[model samples]
Target chain A: MHHGPAAELGKDYSIEYKTRLGVILFFIYLLVYAGFVFIGVFYPDLMGITALAGLNLAFVYGMGLIVLAIIMGLVYNYFCTRHEDKMNKEAEL
Target chain B: MIYTVSPSAIVIFVIFVLSVLGLSFYFARKSKSASGYYAAGGNIHWFVNGIAFAGDYLSAASFLGICGMIAFFGYDGFLYSIGFLAGWVVALFIVAEPLKRMGKYTFADALDAKFDSRAIKLTAAISTLVVSIFYLIPQMVGAGALVTPLLGFPHWVGVVLVGSIVIFIVATAGMTSTTYVQFIKGGLLIVFSTILTIYVLNNGIKLTPNEDYHKFQTIPVVMEQDKILEIESDSYHLKTQHTEGGVTFVSLDNQGIETWWSLNRSGSEPFLEEALSIVTTADGEKLYNGAPKTDGRFYQVGHASKIIRNGQEVTETGPLGPFEFIEAIENTDVTRFLKKVFEVDGNKVTVFYQTITPGKDIMKPGLYYKLGDKGNLWSRLDFLSLMLALFLGTAALPHILIRYYTVASQRAARKSTIVAIASIGLFYILTLYMGAGAMFNGGLDMESSNMSAPLLAKTFGIVLFSIISAIAFATILGTVSGLIVASSGAVAHDLMDKYMKIKMTENQKVNAGRISAVVVGIFAIILGIIFKDQNVSFLVGLAFAIAASSNLPAILMLLFWKKTTSRGISVAIMVGMISSVLIILLSPTMYEIYGLKASDAPIPLQNPGIISIPLGFITLVLISLMTKKHRATK
Candidate 1:
């Protein structure tokens, strides 16, 4: 009846830092996404206004959320990987 | 709409399917072990896995359903795209690393990692099976919808064809073959969609793409002091006139053929306009456009009725930029068809009449989500609930979580997720253009929105149409195979090996998994046939809701909270799964399905995520606190 993670975290010294960074980025994206659902529900007509370029707020805001997710994902990966390398190098030394 | 089977589509479809089977057979040798059969032996490269993620996630619902919805309803379908892509953020930031570090085979492996409790393994395994089957229905149904015009086969034939192919794929090589099939499908879907979007932009907006687009034969009428008068046109003979619902309709007889036309009044002048109608006579023979279904008389619909640039009206706008196309549509008027069904003298008649709607109005939330004049508070709640479920669902999906285990390390998992987000996001952006193209071009088939993307491809030429349809079939094949693999893993690994404690060799485990794949594939084919006529996107939304409610609560709590006990995890999964399914069964949409009035349903909300998701979290917290002292003493 033994059950645990199939692979251990080993000597990954950046585990604490990575979890903190992941949680923060998750909340940041959650708020942005919640704002979209909010406007879509209550102020739907406001979305029809011309916002960016020539498209309506609905189109612009919706596209903005998608682009922001991509940016945040890449940013999360870059910083997390850098920290993992840095902390593990310090631990080895 | 009547469809003609394309010979090129059949040839292309056979080739695409054969290549997929060939990949499966080639990879079969590598998956002899249980680990290889389930998770590809943790050997897939990060980049290939990333595109495979896109291929597995896109499903037929994303390409066909979303495009059709946007084509018909404008921007509401784009809302689905935005929500679906945003869910990847959850997977990338929170779930990817820990999930890869913990699980070996299935999603249940991750949840059961914290405790060796049999209840935890059983509940998690059951939840995975439930979510996978729910997700499989839409992909299988979409396969049937595509085969009708592509290979000109019956719906059941398509269902069986896809089911049998997917079964063979999963049973032969498992995750290795599924991943490669998805990688190829994902790459082709993105490249060809970009090509189709270019064609749409190149053609631009046309008031009449063809000669007969606006030629519905409008004739002016003469009246003598509101008394009997002779019509001005000698071509058509007015046979009979009737008024229903305060609108007048005249039955016209032309060369021994009779059809219905609506009367329109322009200020003080009256005119007769020909309309499209499908009639089922008392003898049970169906007619399309006042002719038999095989007559090839049914017309292709949806076009820009009016095009404008700046402040002036124009006939066409040539080769506009991406942003310019949206601006042009904003100032133009498009012809959208609306349907009404009525019975006259035991004969059922459905008429599709044209309505000229402003582009500004069409590009808003009113069409599908309905926060406009026709919508009330409940509609807004339904919209919010669906968006919430879609956002939370992706990371919780069993099939998606298992992909995190296929890579070598947690870092590869994170990188692959980013790749998925980028590719899937770009494809979604292309969907907005393809949808608008179908909306303005004469490519819409009113019967099924799932046909919109392929039908839009047909307007370019048969070669593009054949290739796009084959890619769409591959899209379905890739997704269905993934779902079957996930389900088989749940059955053989979680349910049997872990819970039942069936002492078996590695060979026996792989054999059991292959048998499970066959069973699950057959079950999916049956459900696909039963739900053949259901909307593809709507079913996908339900799958998302169920996953978000049932699986997300337990996974989040197990990872982040110290008080999450095995009892809490098992009970919460059941409560979440049962309550969500119950609420859906009692929702207004189900009431309509039962042939009852929507308002007569007890629950007002169409989506149960707003309530059921919170309920799951609450149940887990209460149960864990109650069992805390008991567990400590034990």
Candidate 2:
């Protein structure tokens, strides 16, 4: 596949940067899931505490996925715009 | 029904109305462009939009219906909460960004983005209006229900009051005021519900034995050659019988009777303390709480308390966590409960509580066809089909789909969805406790399960009762506004401007949308008043089924299926829309709504998603194949 215009622009700028962001997001999801499992297994008493009240692990993980999707979209947009501008300049040249 | 209208409830109602009107007036100036009116200029913050999503999604059905169900039916009501939250997964993962990228304002915009077809636009717009109206009925009914107890006004008065207020809100500000109102109300609903759940857990369960409660008795008499027969409480019966019956009978003892009994060591009590004691005596056999009488005398049929696992009793060593509680219930016999029924003399009195054990086939829908036996395959499939429709339908809802356009970019759309999921998911978890708390709180109005949560709050105090009820009303307003906006956008943008080729500037388009909003709001109010007595959640479920059948197939096909021509999408929408609506209108639900006998129903039941959704996809494929050559030539 061509990786699309967006992906090409990301590569030209720094593939390493995008990869790092992805890795960070993956870890965030990992942390949330892990936290819930820990609470479920060890600190069971704190499961429904009012302080932690509405913050369930499943919810945190779900929210993390949402955050990751948005970040991905933003990265994709940035690359797509840059690539489109560059392509237009090259055509003019 | 014997409720005194509290001053606080009146004040809160007035304040809410005024605040909404104020916001409407403020936004009225800015809502001159179509984008501003329909999409709030597409510049709302993700956080606000996310909460507004909660506001739009959680109507009377979510706030009142689930809670009432839980109060009356125990865990069964909470199952609805789980189902609703599950549907959000489809919206977040599957539809969020793609919808944002595709649509301008309405759900039809996304489906017809590539096609630019008049048929698609008209069909999709009509679908949006129909679904919105269906959903509005329940909210309006809920509004009327709230008014009876909260304001001491009649049900129709409540419907008209809410209808007028909502119309003003939508007509004045369009989406802008609705969004903020929803945001505020959504936040309050979550906070107050959490507080109520805390109160419930802290109070814990209480043992209310059959004794120590007042029981009312009714005596029936035959008079005037059995033509002017009458049944009344002893106090009223004496007077009526003397005048009407003109028959000398035994002296009836008239006194408010109270019985006192102790709870068994196992700690199980009758469902309703007062309701349980008035057992029906048949052939000198006293039936206590619907349980079979052992001797031909009054005996205490105490509730047996045991920690049940799966379908059998188990021992709980100590307090369990939430998930653990769910697990325990899943694996144990903790599901059995004492039920109450009331009946008259010589007839099996339905006025006693019977111990109920949900059968193993409880999870399978339509398992109990004739009440005792499990339902057959068709019924089971129908239930699954309804659930499938609900699960996938959220992403396709016109109101929900339009929310994606409120944010600026696809990334923002995705992020806002994530935030919504988190917030909504959190709130749904709270609903479980709130529902369960209401279930066991002994404050449920059995006739109307939707009153469970609010009535539960009333048990605490009128202040909380007023606030919770008001927030619940706001919940309906928020959702109704979102739906009106969606329908109006569909009419003004997709149908009138796009399909009908009406040339209009942004200002004119905005005016058209505003006018449409008023019209839709009026229609919604009328339907709401019409369906004032039906269950709100059931109505919402029908809306979901329609949304899934009519919109999901076309949306999914356009995004993923390349061969999905414009003709295919248009055909799928039309088929889905027509079939689901027709099926619902002819189904058993319509029998009651349309005042017809059950046998007169054209379809088996109201839920038609199982057959209709698949039919929509199949029709699209066949039509696309037939027109493939024509499409290529064009």
Candidate 3:
């Protein structure tokens, strides 16, 4: 049976490579997110501590999660595009 | 509680609705083919689709509900924003590329691509319809909520108006029109919210007693030898006195108008606190502030009682940065109103009295979520379950999944998602400032938290208020139309053509979709009217739980697991959807909705995500193994 995705990303860009990188980045974000939730649920007093500047840990950590997701998304796109371009040219040669 | 209909608001609202309708008509000619109607011909630009994703994703719940929650409850609302934006991470990293490559038009197409299973198509189609309806109810309820103040219409009128407009948009141009509409809405929502945030920061923190309705005036009571005597007032005469629960409430009359005031004693000094009340007599007559509803006497509430900066109580902090605004609120004493209802002498009285909450408590969790050592295990588990649902739900939403097909290729889908993450992430950050702004400014409606952001805009000026309210209406319209498109595609493409094997021409398929949109729109209006009193954000959280529990496991397993048989997929979906919905219906929240005691509910959990999500994964794995062995025996 045919396998992997139906749409071709590039001539030789590895699906395994992209999926692996994505899973790793996803797990990294998940770990950080779990920390926020853990602190919120179990150690509610900790979220009130001043984390950065004058903002409370709840505000700082909450805003941090949103900012980190955007940065990670851009980073994922940047690396995937670079690998896709290089690999596709090599296959043509 | 009192709203004066502004003509300018109605005019601006009409123009916004007209322009959105005009765009739909302009795109109608291009949506003739089934492909164009369903997937926008798979030709949307990655940048536009990305912003459109933001437009489609940020329903009235995001803009109105979260801001209101933060305004009233503080940091808990921002928790929703964090969880919501985090869900997009799952969308981008795990779901985007493969979904774009596998599916043609609907989410069912991707699921059934491997085995061409009719059972998969039917179950997925049904799940899409159920989730869309669950999501649509809140948008319609939000539409009704905005209409009452902005247009001075009844709640049902707002529901019918949004349903009709969204139906026309979806039935005419389908996804082609929907994408452009969402793009415009997404752009307008971000720009106007940023403007509102700027205004909030510029105004800074201030102690506003909201004396526009009635100034807070107290008179010393005349006492005779340790005995209580009547208080003297030049303009008001004491009319009636009733003491209940050790608090003496006296009705005071000024000319022909009357209102309730409570007696307070500090040491040996006695004073009175002014209050606002809605009284309904046994004769079935309603009174606002002890007068007619149209007396225009209800005061605008919500302002800082004391603004403390560096341990010094100040009248106001003129201008502050975004971080400074939050930091300042942390030390302030905000004037919040609490409502209490009771029947005295067979007349029902609801009194809204002032409460002083420190800014530090306002920025913490306990106001709404009930966490920490003070909260029980059930409450903490409920909070975690809701966060889990919000995180996993975004990737599983049918309307969001359908947007992946609107882009031209897998690369376009991936790139567009990054754009959505950035756009939506910035908007969520702005919500924190606006929410705090609403709290310290006189912008809250004691009756509904959904009106906080718009009413906050009113404090700036009527023109800014008009523009912001119209954009909120557009927010509702954009999300409702996207839901209808997803629903129509499920009916025509997945259920009828794929599962039933209906041999229909392109024109007939498009006709079927239009019919389905009309039906779904009417159904949404009915539910919106029925559930008008329910909280907008709470209903949305339920939608997320259902989607995450039912659809996410099936899609994730199909993508990552080789042994996921078609029968396993079908049964897992049915079991997951039923279990999540059943738990929600039986949970304490629904018991409260049913007018029963919450403690009587069999299931103690408020949210079903933690249990149902794991249940979905386990069921899928177990069923797949058994089905594989059966196939081998055959």
Candidate 4:
């Protein structure tokens, strides 16, 4: 929300918020690696199966990951903005 | 090989193009600011950016070239997809956040962050232009390739059309419009490709007996002594040789061959009988399509089918999976399938199969080796080097690096990159299926492998074909715009302003960037026209090689090395850029693609990364050490 060094450095954020955000990112990372493992092990036959005109399931999943990444960013932005706003109001009071 | 473009295809193409243009126009107003134009004002949502990343990264080579290669060759083509996806791990884990945090506008920005030197700016700018131009050629060629089947136009016309449209896009909106275009194109590419892949799985594989298919006719003719004649047909052409045997043997043209077979028809009978042909020469030389005779007189006929597994006719018959298909070929006696060659009434033709074994000379460096050999070390290494370049080059690219600046925070950069990787990974996976489907569906073109995916779509219906082709065209436009923007920024911000010391205001710099975009656009158009026939994927590989060799070393060293100087970075960039270009120009690819004499080439082979990439790092390190004393004294 606020455009300065404080936000980038995480100077104003509480430890709990930081930890929560970190956990979320970690889960996302886990999900990605899990997807890779699943594709590698579970469905080797369908790994590169062409399901559409010129695309396969693997390609679709890869694109899906990209979409999920963007959504994650927006969610992070929204939460961060709200947290910052709440903190700012408390400080004023 | 003859194709008839239906009216539905034309209408779909028009609609797709209009939609893309409309998006560009809508975003035109937001792209006025330098930050907005070059980096989308750092405001793009991560998810949209992620898909756009996939769209921008996939290019024509990934879609067309890789698929065609796989359809023709075996598992070797899929290696490219694996290598490409593997490179993203490097982007995600190593380079993403750092790159976003370091630069503001261009790749040079990141490299020049620690040292504000003119030399670094100039060399980095030059590398950007060089790599972008190299990358542009294939996209243009791909555009031309698409137009031929979809709109029935000459290759040059497609190149010109893409050039004009891309130039207009870049000159008007720069990165902002480019990103949105890529986003839209990426989404559509994935969606439509998904639909097509499902169709393939549902239809599954059907065995068409040899007797139930139309056969291609092979014709043999004598040319002027020792002369090579390229037989041209409305759809495809056959290349054959004249041996000691008489000229009655005609080789079936594999490159131009497009086999069409129906799955089920209205007739009460389940299967229909079709003609098959074979020609045997007087020299006792057996030919499937066309090969010169050795001992016996040539005999030609139709309606013959003896499936050979490995030069022997097979007794077994059934369905096969991907691996099984190859195994079947390896285990059984499948010398050749009987096919017919069309001829006018009262015309004589010869048909034979030329035993094609891997040539010993093909192991050597040059276009002859890379395109000829299947599993040789050098060929494999050539592919490896290309994969390395593509993987490493993404994070190091000036245009791609600039995307980080569009976001608000380092975390955003990291998040956006993660998304990009996922999308990119998914899309690459799809390419394998798309490519393999085209291979078995009997839609592949041996002469031009790049058209495999689109032509495969044509088998389903015209509407699907048009939409897929149009999206592919849009894919080219999105990528070219990004490249042009990066190159133009280099020229304006790094070269003219920094190296030339023009001392221009921000507004002037922005204007200069626009002008440079026009210039780069013009340059790309010229190169695209010149290199019209080469594979788009191969061209992308060359671009990757240049990027890896020139940019990667400088960026990596600057980031981790404490004592790296401006002089070292500049020297490394110049050395890498110059050496790679010189090697590639002299390599065998030039001879093959450009028709240059191999002896005349400066380098022996196509890939220079094996030597030049390391040399770039060494140059940076050594130069940094040599210059360390001067800085210490100062």
Winner by DockQ: 1
Candidate 1 ranges with C-alpha deviation above 4 Å: A1-10, B211-214, B219-273, B372-374, B629-634
Q: Report how far residue B147 has shifted in candidate 1, in Å.
A: 0.7
Model 1 per-residue lDDT tens digits across residues B1-634: 7778988888999988889999999999998988789989887889999999999999988998889889988888888899899989888888888788768888888887767778888999999999899899999999999998898888899999999999999999999999999999999999999999999999899987655444566767765644325456777787666566655666677786667676666457887767777889999998776678787656777888788787778889989888888878888899887666677778787766666789997777777777845678788879988998899999899988888878878888889999999999999999999999998887787777888899888888899999999999999999999999999999999999999999978889989999999999999999999888777878888888899889999888887888888899889999998888898889987888788987899999888998888889999999999888523111
Candidate 4 segments whose C-alpha is farther than 4 A from its true place: A1-93, B209-213, B216-241, B244-377, B597-602, B629-634
- Arrange candidates by DockQ, highest first: which order? 1, 3, 4, 2
lDDT of candidate model 2 versus the reference: 0.64
On TM-score, the leading prediction is: 1
lDDT of 4 by residue, B63-166 (tens): 88877765554334654665566555545545555566556678887777666777887889999888888888888889888887788787788888888888
Error at B207, model 1, angstroms: 0.9
Q: What is the alpha-carbon lDDT for the whole of candidate 1?
A: 0.86
TM-scores of the models, in the order given: 0.95, 0.73, 0.94, 0.72
- List, residue by residue over B154-213, the lDDT tens digit for candidate 3: 999999999999999999999999999999999999999999999988888878633463
Q: For all candidates, state DockQ relative to the true structure.
A: 0.61, 0.05, 0.50, 0.06
Clashes of 2: 27
Q: Residue-pair clashes per candidate, as listed?
A: 0, 27, 0, 67
Ranking by TM-score: 1, 3, 2, 4
- Chain B TM (all candidates): 0.94, 0.80, 0.93, 0.78
